[model samples]
Target chain A: MSNAISLRGLEKTYANGHQALRGIDLDIKHGEIFALLGPNGAGKSTLIGAVCGLVKATGGSIHIDGHELPRQYREARAKVGLVPQEMVNEGFESVLSSVRFSRGLFGKPPAPKLLEQILRDLSLWNKRDDATMTLSGGMRRRVMIAKALAHEPQVLFLDEPTAGVDVELRRDMWAMVRRLRDRGVTIVLTTHYLEEAEEMADRVGVISDGRLLLVENKTDLMARLGRRQLRLQLQQPLTQLPADLAGFPVELVDQGRELVLDVARDNQGIADFLRRLAANDIDFKDLHTSESSLEDIFVELLRKPA
Target chain B: MNFYSIHAIFRFEMARSVRTLMQSLAAPVLATALYFVVFGSAIGSRMAEIGSIPYGSFIVPGLTLLAVLTQSVSNAAFGIYMPRYSGAIYEILSAPLSPTEIVFGYVGAAVVKSMVLAAAILITARVFVPYEVAHPFWAFFILLLCAVSFSMLGFIVGLCVDGWDKLEVVPSLVITPLTFLGGSFYSLNMLPPTWQTISLFNPVVYLVDAFRWAFFDVTEFNPMVDVAFLLGFLLVCIVIVGQIFRTGYRLQH
Candidate 1:
């Protein structure tokens, strides 16, 4: 099957001559959670806006479920939903009415039972009659999701859905997202929390400076781009580097009491690093290895130009 | 164009607006009552009848339309403005709604709100001046038309405006002045012939004259001519606002 969402050479520029997105090309698969990772002003929102027809694309084209945007907008948009970054709703509105109205906006007939099911899924069933402003921040966020899911679109976009939410709510939201994925909803999310992306996304795309730096499967991307660090505790402290250990790519720490070495992600490099440490007669009290996390890779990607 | 969808949106908007009763309905009605007590009873007691109707009755049509006009415009403008301000418009924009549905939903709800206010003012006016509706059907038709037209106008203004201050500008400077000069408290017949001719230039005059004609069966100007003018104004507003929605002017963003 074709990709659920496809972007080709997408470029967006604001009226003030600020370029938001520059020639972004990407494909998101159906039924998978795709995470777009970026820093502030990196065009993650702009990218989602372009797909959902909120922002006009300066150049290039977008296809939603094989339908072109701004031309086939009605059909393309009907299949997708977006949860924006801000908290927006009528404070006086009931949760049920808000979600029901969202369904009506999609030209769907009033379906009270379906709306009830949605509210139930989001754990907002009890608060259905409550005014939105009376609810807590987390509950309001759930209302946003319930509103987006009212029409049961094929794809959903969560833009920092858990920015300031508490731990329990965040975990609950992730579980709900997983349930949606299980039910065949393709989710595209943009988040500053690399850990969320790392835990949820099947494929990850890093965006920086309005350009896409990389798009790879979570496991493959980590294995291919992931780096490991080996910290060796020295037996004796010294003022300067030892002569024999100079050939190894290592840095001294704790006044020569420890050695920090960056090893390739490959299996052989780790073994070779170990062999070299032994050959150099380096005495270490302890050693620990750590793989580079998504946060580390995300920071690195931002520092490098696309 | 689909009635059901528009109805859903219309109902949603109406519920939202009415929920804020203190600001939307009560405040405007109370203000209109004070206007009647101060302007209608005070000044009306001194002024003589104009065109076979008491000054208070003559002003009633204008005041009614004024209530309808401002409330209509504000209901739609604020309804749209709040969503845009709160960033909730993103939710609506991303939904399956078309601009037409969105516009009509908001404008329709505005008309409903203005009508509710009109009803309240009409009832309150009965308490102050025991005036009866001369041609109740015509009166109802004219009020409905005025409400819908101004509500559509407000919808256009709301979509084009960016900030809160911009939202209040059109209603504050334009609608208020137009209603005052539209002969709400005085008759064009009371003015000099030349000024009377100039008064005809005010689009609101046609609405006020037509509304008064519906109630008293008497008007300073020809009722047929005034109706034609009001109908023309309504058509123009519809066309312009419809074009704004069609072109996505200032709204799609």
Candidate 2:
């Protein structure tokens, strides 16, 4: 089947001569969780806005579920949903009315039962009659999500979904997102939290300076770029490393109390390295191995020259 | 042609107004009622009749049109402006909605609101003084034209201004003063020739005159000119509105 959402050579230059997006090309597949990671002013929001039809792209073509933008906009837009960063609500209007308004704006026939189910899913059914402004900040954000889902869109774009929520709520939201994915809705979210992408995304994309640095499978990316460390607590302190073990990539930490050896995860030869250390009469009281986290990989990727 | 979206926006706006009934519906009606009590009851009892019609009855068309114009501009302005202020505008902008549909949603609501206020004012005026509409069809037409025109003007205001003060500036500083100067309370015939010539420069003068003519059948200007003025004002606002949507003005960036 075709990609759920597609973009080719997307470019946007504001009237002030600021270029927000530079040649962005991406495809989001159905039923997959894709996370876009970028730093401030790196064009992540611009890319999302362009795809959602909020920002007019200067160049490029957007296709949503086989419908092209600016031409088949009605059909294309009908398939997409966006949960923006702002916690805006109709202060005087009830939560239910707000969601209904969103459903209507998307040209959907009113389905009261479906709307109620969405509110229930968001845990907003109890607050349906309350004015939106009376809710807490987290509750307001949930209301935003309900509005996005009101139309039952096929492709959902969530911009910083867990920006300001508490950890428990964040986990709940992640579970909710996974349920949506299981039901076959394509999910694309942009986030500053690497852990969010690490935990939620099936595929990871790193963007910097308005260009996508790389897009790869999450597990493959971590295994390929993630480095491992074998930290051994030495049995006895030594002044320096022995010439015999100089071939190994190692460093002394904890004032020479421990030896840390760098290891490539997929290409690790810990057995040979351990045998060599035994042959050299070097002994360690205890040792442990650790791999680089997604945060590490993110920092390493961004630290590289664009 | 997203009529559903337009209808959704209309319902949303109407609900918003209903939620604030005391402010939106009751306040304007009360404000207009004060005009009837003060001008029609208090002053008209002592003043001479203008053009063989009771001074109280003569002011009906002018005051009714005044309410429509101010309410149209204010309602349309606030309808779109509040969304921007609260950042809820993104939903509609991103929806598969054409610019025309968005305008129809917002401006349509504004016009409906103004017409309702006009009707409320006319009914309230009945309690203070009696009046007759000589050309009822013409009167409704003028009220509609006035509502649609000023509502568009309000839409433009919403799109063009950024700050709340700026939003209120057009309605309070400009439109209200223009209405007052446009003979909403007195006729241009009552003014000297120089002042009368100057009054013609005020667009509200034409609207008020046309509406008054519909009620009293007395006007200083030709009826066609009044119709042309309303149509021309509406055309200009529509063009400007089209330009704003085309360029995305403050709505996009």
Candidate 3:
């Protein structure tokens, strides 16, 4: 099947000469939750803006389900929805009216039931009559989601949907996103929260310095770059590492009270290292194995020289 | 050409106006009524008639123009500016609506508001001073032209300014002074030759003269010249607003 969204050499350089995006080429699959992982000022928002037609691309093109943007913009834009990072709503307008108005903007006939359902799904039905300004921050974020879904868009771009949200709302949002993907809607989200990407993304794309560093299947990316560590708490204070275990990737930490062993996920070196430690009579109070998270991989990726 | 989009924006903006009726509608009407009470009743009885029209009746078109011009700018400017200020403009920007449709919705609503205010001012003026329109069609023509043109100017102003204070500068300082000097209270004929020549450069003068002629069939400049100038100004505003949308000037960034 064709890609849900496609960009070829997409670029954006502000008039002030800030290159927000440079030569970004990406294709998002249908019904997949693609998480764009990037730090602040890494062109995540800029990429989304260009696709949604809010920011003009200085060069290259974007095609939304085979329709070119800004030319066939009406048709192209009809297929996509955006929930911006900023919490902006028509504050004085009721939640229902605001969402209904958004649906109307897409030239859709008023579907009261669909809007009601969306509001219900986002748990905003109770506040449908309330002015958006009266809503709590979390409720307002849900309202933003309802507005984005109002037009029944096939593809949704959520720019940091859970930023500053409480844990409950964040979990609720993640569940809602999973439900959206289950319904065959392609989801592209940009987030600073690595755990969000780790927990929700089907595919993960890392972007840094206006460049797309890598795009890979979530599990594959994790397994390829993820590291495992064995931390040993020494029973007694040790002055330094044992000479016999110098061949292993072990470092004494916590004022020589702990020994840390770094090993690859697929490496069998840990068993041999443990046998060698026993043979050398190294005593430890306890030991625990920890694996590197997506956060660790992301930080490591960004820390590398471009 | 998306009527649904245009209607959505128009209805939403109109609803906002209804919600703030006091500030959006009543305030302008009451202000115009006060102008009539002060300028028409207090001062009219002492002044001589100008061009066979009573002093009270003569200032009616000028006063109405003043209220409509100021309201047109303020209404349209605030309508667009509020969305930008609140960041709600993203919804409009990301929608399927074209630039022209967006402008149509905003400028269209602004025109409706200014027209309503103009009508209210005209009806209120009748309570304080007696007046009749010699050419009702031309009167409405000038009224609409002024409202739409000034609203477009207001749209441009809203796009250009970044803050609330800057929004007020054009309507308060520039438009108010221009309308006062545009002969809203007195005709250019009342001024000396040099001053009349200088007053000719004031664009509001043409609008006031056209509207006054529509009411009293009396004007210093040719009715055709006033109409031409009004259309010209309207066209210019359309071009500038069109360019703003086309280039996504402040709207995009």
RMSD of each: 3.0, 1.7, 2.3
Worst 10 residues of 2 chain B by lDDT: B62-71
Instruction: Show pairs that collide, candidate 3.
Output: none
| Model 3 chain B weakest lDDT span, ten residues long | B31-40
The top-ranked prediction according to DockQ is: 2
Report how far off residue A140 is in candidate 1 (Å).
2.3
Q: What are the per-residue Cα lDDT tens digits for candidate 1 across B61-149?
A: 88888888988888788888788777777766776566677777888788888888899999998777757788899899889988888
lDDT string for model 2 (A1-306, tens) is: 788988999999988999888898998888899999998888988998988877889999888888888788888888899999878967888999889999999998999999999899888999999999999999999999999999999999899999989987798799999999999999999999999999999999998988999999999999889889998998988789888878889888888899989987764668878998899888899999998889999999999998
Q: Over 4 Å off in model 2, which ranges? A: A243-247, A266-268, A275-281
Per-model TM values vs. the true structure: 0.90, 0.96, 0.94
Q: Candidate 2 docking category?
A: medium
Q: Give the TM-score of chain A, superposed on the true chain A, for all candidates in the order listed.
A: 0.90, 0.94, 0.94
List the DockQ of the predictions in order.
0.57, 0.77, 0.71
lDDT of 1 by residue, A1-306 (tens): 778999999999987899999999999999999999999899999999888767878899999999888788778888998888888856788899888878887777888999999899888999999999899989999999999899888999999988999999899989989999999999999999999999999999999889999999998988777888888888876677767667667789987898888876664456676777778677778989888999988888777765
Q: On a 0 to 100 scale, what is the lDDT of residue A105 in model 2?
A: 97
**Residue runs of model 3 more than 4 Å from their true location after superposition:** A234-284
Clashing residue pairs in candidate 1 (N, C-alpha, C atoms within 3 angstroms): none
Reference contacts recovered by each candidate, as fractions? 0.64, 0.79, 0.79
